[model samples]
Target: MFQIFTSFFIIYGSKGGCPMTITKKLVPVIIACCLLFSLFLPSVQAQAAAKFSDVDPQRYGWAMDAISFMTDRGILNGYPDNTFKPGNSLTKAEFTAMLYRLFDKYRPNMQEEDADLRLAGYADVPETHWAHKEITAIYDYYFGGIAFAFKEGVEEPFFQPEKKLTRLELAQIMYMAIPFADDAPGASCQVIMGMTDIPYELFSSYEEADEYRFDGRYSEDTGISVDYYVSEGAPVLYPLVLVKESDGSCSSSFDDYSSIIESAVASMHTSGIMTADDSGYFRPHAPVSRAEAVTILNRTYNYLKANRNLQQYSSLETSSAAAGTPVTNPQPEPPAGKPSSTVNPAGNVKTFTRDLAVEGELETMIDTEGYRSITVSIEAKEKVDVIVQLGGKKSFIRHEELPQTIALNGIKQVSLETQKRVFDLLNRDADYTAVLTVELK
Candidate 1:
């Protein structure tokens, strides 16, 4: 009918850039084509939308945009039954597949065979595994340069693909996937510590916990507390927090992996790629769910798209060494005519004295170039623990009394030393200060 042909032309002719004029001779052909298209339009739209039946808008309103963006682009797929098990724990293999698919969507030139070849070096990811190609591609593309050894002292390298991914692990992977800026600033340990929201119920002693709680008031077990050092409206730093020891020394809940995990979580949070739950908890050790993974990936993609100049991990030049391993480079001498404390011309030794006010912690980075030995003298009002990390080596200066001295030899740089937990119980605003004297010889 003429009406039907007119409706089809109005809907598709203008948009498709076809001639708008209708001719009597071509009407029969056009009508047949439009009839065929009408039969398939609803199915085509349904396939393109890819909406999951279980993803109710009311329950998953926060993740609706992310889910739609990923699924519509074919970056994520639901089960055969059309349900997305959003709450189920995501395995490492699943996460890897998702990441690889996302990368492929953006960088289509990457070949699957080349990615598969990269995984030949791994021990666990067999050729027949369902996600072997994806796992190989992600690992080789992002972490190829970093050395891997089994933490249990085994020589074989293993990729436990079936293991459930944890929040901390996800943060670390996301952090590594993006290349760091050349002038990226170092993350502060204190800031990372403050971002961790610890549940108040976990504290062993209520009397001891009263000092850190807000207004000295105890709430329900479900209540959480962000440490006093964290500013209001600041992002949560890490999912894990430092545990207070009975001996008054604070130790990381992550133990040996504490520093790296804290740094990764802090970087992700600061970059707006990952965040905490409604209760202000990162839940670092908890298993990452499918919905959370996609949401985070969506955020990462958006961030990368916004910052067009930033380079991805796949574009970086990698070496055999670990990602953060410090490389010693030649340094230029300090400019002449600069003031130095007690400079000796014969030995070229200079002593620098600084008085630092320690609230939560104080971090200092000292260049140890053109020097043989360095000595640090500390004088504090109260007992404090000074942690010195240089060239991957950590030394401690626990001031049981006061006025202690420590010496370092053959060090290219002293990266960070933090003086922690000098609480002024009587006056909260008071500063517990320390005097640090560094002598470079």
Candidate 2:
């Protein structure tokens, strides 16, 4: 037992000479390794059961792909109940446990003198977490003298280890330690702020948002908080990538932007939409057709909305002047182009009862260019038109009703997929803007 868990650490922990000499004093290590190896023998050849379908494909990016690969190699696994909660941030314990599964051992003698950073002892976890021993051991032996984000003596604290990680934060962590896969030439990590006009200072200096820009341009770098341009009557939030048409032609069309895929991947990485591969490449620039984009966006939106840390919309409920349920406060304005829908400040995520669609109609409007969110409630189950317009073009106007909710074993589940590749084709000229409408009655 002792040898079984200690071998990996001993090998990876040592530096000056042959750590793999199979020391005579630890002969029990050989026997224990054999016993455990035999006991869990069949698992060695086992394949992972996860796939891209196991993840939210669109928003997750290469992280999902890498996880699927490691999982299949038997170096990783799903939960006890057969679900891989991929979006959940890994606790230090959970991550260390995964490392153990990968190598199957520990290094108790490893000195943890120079920690990259130490977690301030949380009141609830004063070295009692199952991972305390392993984490301390690894820190002592392997990761000495490294500088991680936290302070050593535990003053203010890294308060939320359990908090979901953002895609960028995870990338930063991996980039700091692991080797990143290089981006293609001219496929640099570029962060665009004030999409209309990027800031001069941010171009060279640093900011939180600049990290994103640098991430796109440089493979690894620090962060900077990039703001929009103070001049040119730009919106309050500065430098975002304002993608224009080929001729600097300004069109609200979502179609002209295949370049956004890189942005999406970067966004996914920082926001925890995806996990990181020890290899740092996030292939965001690959070509993705609009159909793929829609599917990806839909899945990404679902994951983002489901996770609490990423939820940023302040108000969502909008009571139409006609028959919609009363929204407490006025709906917050929609993103550019879409007419503003009022929402409550309290920001209740309304579970649109199927009943709302039975009598009222979903309205659609657009006057600017950017992202927007709208939800239609169904008072009852019935065929209804969900009118969608992106960048001012009506893409899909169809009548469909939600499938009746069904219980599988003990949980409620829903699945949706588009039919016959609607809204996207191989042709380049098909891009168009749209406004969404969930028509009622």
Count of clashes, each model? 1, 63
Q: Give lDDT per model, in order.
A: 0.50, 0.30
Q: What is the C-alpha RMSD of each candidate to the true structure, in Å?
A: 16.8, 26.5
In the range 45-107, model 1's lDDT, one tens digit per residue, is 243235577776657665666676567666677889888777789888888888877765423
lDDT of 1 at 92: 82
TM-score per candidate: 0.45, 0.27
**Candidate 2, 1-441: lDDT as tens digits:** 555556764776467855755577656756666786778653211222233334554454424434543454444566666765555444444444443343333332252222322232433334766655544443221121121222334433232333332333333322222212222211222322212222212222122332444323211221111110011222222123222322222211111111222333333444333423445543322222222222232233333234321123112212212111111211112324322222222342323222211111222232222213333333222233343323211222233333222122321111111111111222234322222223211
Model 2 Cα displacement at 428 (Å)? 57
- Candidate that would win on TM-score: 1
lDDT: worst 10-residue window of model 1: 321-330
The deviation in Å at residue 88 for candidate 1 is 1.7
Question: lDDT of candidate 1 vs native?
Answer: 0.50
